[model samples]
Target chain A: MPDLGLEVLIKGNNLGRLLGGLWIAIEISLLSIAISIPLGILLGILMTRKNRLIRFLTKFYLEFIRIMPQMVLLFLVFFGTTRSMGWNLPGETAAVIVFVMWGTAEMGDLVRSALLSIPRHQYESSESLGLSRKQTYFYIILPQTLRRLIPVSINLITRMIKTTSLILMIGVVEVLKVGQQIIEANRMSSPNAAFGVFLVIFILYFVICWSVSMTARYLERKWS
Target chain B: MDFAYIERVLPLYERAAALTVQLGMEGILLSIVIGLVCALILYEKIPVLRRIVMIYIEVSRNTPLLVQLFFIYYGLPKIGIVLTPEVCGVAGLAFLGGSYMAEAFRSGLDSVEDIQRESAYSLGMNRMQTIHYVVLPQAVSTSIPALLANIIFLLKETSVFSAISLMDLMFTAKDLIGLYYKTTESLALLVIFYLMILLPVSIVGAVVERRVRYAGFGT
Candidate 1:
């Protein structure tokens, strides 16, 4: 048998450091998710409006965000704006900003589709019952929309959490970054540290994302 | 923002863009093959292979490509398996995209009515002929939107190829930005190049989706 270099993780403070890094990634995504939900609801409502310009703008923003990869957006926010605007933005701040922009667009789209999916007859039936506009929305439309949105938004949460891993590339010192640092420190002592460290990071990500997606699936099954 | 700077970096971006497209196309093709194989295995309900494919789909779908890239590029060498960065990039994309493509194909396959397969069998067609002549055409037609979306997705994911030191578009933009501090110029060019590569594909995908709907293939 050979040295697997798994010991590097047990070596003092290494695993702790990785966990701390994971916390940062989690913090960024959670912050964006918190901010995104309300703003996304607003954007979603705006997207469904009959106005032409608002529709065009919302459509354009969605398409533009969809077309641009999040990595490029990260680079643009982290590196591009700092120099161009002379603003000193931290890596974590830039990560959150970009993630918010992305999450809002995605969440907004999800909301729009969910709202559209409500049949026209539902609204007609509500009006026939002599419910006020606000009452109809509060009573009928919102609840169904919430049901459709919950599972999908849970999926977006997982996507955001997984994508936060890319923030390491911008020097955010996230889990992957911390893992790389440990691997570098132990390179002479542990030739297999890369394998060990990356495998651990991969498992860490898998566990978090897997649980989130599992929740989404459970809700989808229960609801449908 | 800077016209002259953009002009100077245009050649670098062009070369990198070519590599990105090449890598993405190769990865998409490979992923389709891998995905189709897995989907078929699941569709046939192969006992042991079904379990393995299910596990593969879950693991790959849950993990990020960045970590997967790190594993293959850095970790595999530890156990005496070495792959060039280009190879690793393609492998990573295929690994990530394969699960998605498999899900898409599996859904399409599931949507095909069982009555059609039985009809083909009653007409004296063998299993292979039934699958090839009756099932696949309808399955693939229904899967067109998902497959096209996956293709665009795989292409966008190529941005992370820079992590493995592939000289792809993202790498070129970062290199130029670092050297000149011309962030706007570099990033703008990066976005333009990506759009050039992706926008047409999406437009074509939309057109194809519309055509398929009109042609009543999936229905």
Candidate 2:
């Protein structure tokens, strides 16, 4: 067994780089969630519309997003679009765009499901009180939907953070990529450095996700 | 639709699709086995093993499969633990899928009533015998829908293997697009290929879910 030196991991500014990469992951996730939530709610509402054409369009979009892999979506936005359309998007910008697109579809499905799960009596009660359709949704439905949405959206945030690792393939300097770089740089000094670096990456990811899950649970209990 | 171009690329994509299906099958099998074993250990309440399994699930579920794949592929080589791209891909999928499957199975186990175990014990069955004959059989039946959905999710995620140079369907589509610069055609073909595989799995999942619910499993 190769001895993995902890001293090497802590010294030489490696800690700072790792934290920087983690912050980038967090930033991308936040931006994607910010854009996805409202867009997803709107699309989800449209999906439930009585109109055939609008419902079909929304369903098609949802299915298309669900069927495609995130990696493919990333490739389409980062590589195919720029090459085909002469649009020079930065790697981070491309990552966020793809993430939001993916997140919106996922969140839309969640929102639609949550909305459907609400007891129809709530809508009926609002209607009997002379509430308009829009007011019924806002005053009666949306708050309950928001409660259910919180946990699932937090799960999605965790997913987005994890998925951000894929951006490293397109040359973004995220945590995993930084770990790879550090391992590559120190390959000669310690051949087993890669395993050590990855252990750190795994621990970092575990902390972030476990905390989010705890927060989701807390919110669920509090809201319920 | 350009039949000529599609016809030329059809064989390549078909071969790649076969590989994707193979990977999905092998990965799902391995994950389910590992996941079931982990769930069993947890259910049995093995001392240190339970904590270790929990940590494994937590870590694997939290991280992205792509990073895990890269770590297994590129990172492992630096430590003289080299795995071929295909092995790395399957291992990554199994590790990630196993975590989700473990959770599903655990939930399934929880859903099994405590009285059933007591009844089994009253019938003079040993612990292992009771679990294998009574608890696990019912758990497996109830968890079928969750397992199927998890497997399909694994199948979709297998597309990420294209990045590590696996000759999966997505890789074939990427190569074709790179060569022909026909973005729409390549993506269209790839989308159809995925639907052909995923739609059946999804239908099966829905059917199983409905069956479980009808059986009073409340799924």
Candidate 3:
């Protein structure tokens, strides 16, 4: 009877806690992407400039972010920078900052690739129509880029949402952290609760990511 | 920039780098085996098994590697399934890497056109033999670039093990930053360490991608 009651508890409050954590994960990921996509597009355009130095600097920044682990980047921005510079940042703020930085670099690369994939004929046609370079980008290149960018950007969003689990280490009360807390609290009372909690966490993540992937596939098929 | 601090920490960083490399290599190896097996199971198209593998891959791929590590390291011990930190770290990485690798291989498998599969069958090869001798070899070649990129991604991700108290290069850097407060220098060195490892891997991936492209598997 006691065991049955415990199972009921897991299926109820435990499930609710998992859902709450997932909400925070989605919130953070969307916020980070909201900052990253526009910044990345602007940076991507700056990176393609004819000026040599801007190209070099943007290339350097992209490569730096690419090679470093996001966790280390999180730690650097959250812990080291705050301590060294005497600036205070909440854990979620730090997590978002690091993710936005990482997300921006990746989005920049995707934008660059999308831009490069645009046919030269389109640019020429737009120019022949007497559009300025700025107008060509705004009216011609940008729309096509957005069409191609949607799938990759959605993939990035999924990545960001998954990666936010790391913010728990820096003390954000996200899903995984909440799972850990619940497992800890119930360890003595319920021996199997830890695995049960983790299983729930895993399922929650799978559902969110699976839906996002389905959306990406739908977008890809529609656009194609 | 202090020579004394560099001298004091160089050996520690080197040792940690060696451990990091070892962990990355072991994790990649394990992941390849696990991923290949899981991929083959899905390729076989068995009903229940395919569904299970799909669920496994999706869950593993969507979750953060750090969260996975913590779950294994902290959560498992509470269940009396204690693993050493190194073992736990490697297992976590392998699980995460395996999921992505399975996706890469599945995409590779998808690239082999249906016409080829029909031709292989017409040649009287059994399904397993057809996959083994025809589809898989081509799929592997087509997938090498993506596989290598995932490997590099996995290598970068192994740095997350430092958070769980693994003595990886990132861990060493964190320790130095803690002790000496040389945040800039320590982090710069860690960045260099990552660059040195990843640059070569990226070049290799690029070379493989070019070759794959030249082979006319553009799709």
Docking class of 2: medium
Off by over 4 Å in 1: A125-135, B215-218
Ranking by TM-score: 1, 2, 3
Off by over 4 Å in 2: A1-11, A83-86, A186-192, B1-3, B217-219
Better of 2 and 3 by lDDT: 2
lDDT of 3 by residue, B91-137 (tens): 99999999888888887888888887899899999998898998898
Stronger candidate by lDDT (1 vs 2): 1
Candidate 3: stretches off by over 4 Å: A1-22, A183-193, B78-80, B121-124, B216-219
Candidate 3, what DockQ?
0.47
Chain A of candidate 2 gets a TM-score of: 0.94
Quote the lDDT for B78 in model 1: 88
Model no. 1, DockQ: 0.83
Per-model root-mean-square deviation over C-alphas: 1.5, 2.5, 3.1
DockQ of each: 0.83, 0.54, 0.47
Pairs of residues at least 3 apart in sequence or in different chains that clash in candidate 1 = none
Worst 10 residues of 1 chain A by lDDT: A1-10
Q: In terms of TM-score, which candidate is stronger, 1 or 2? A: 1
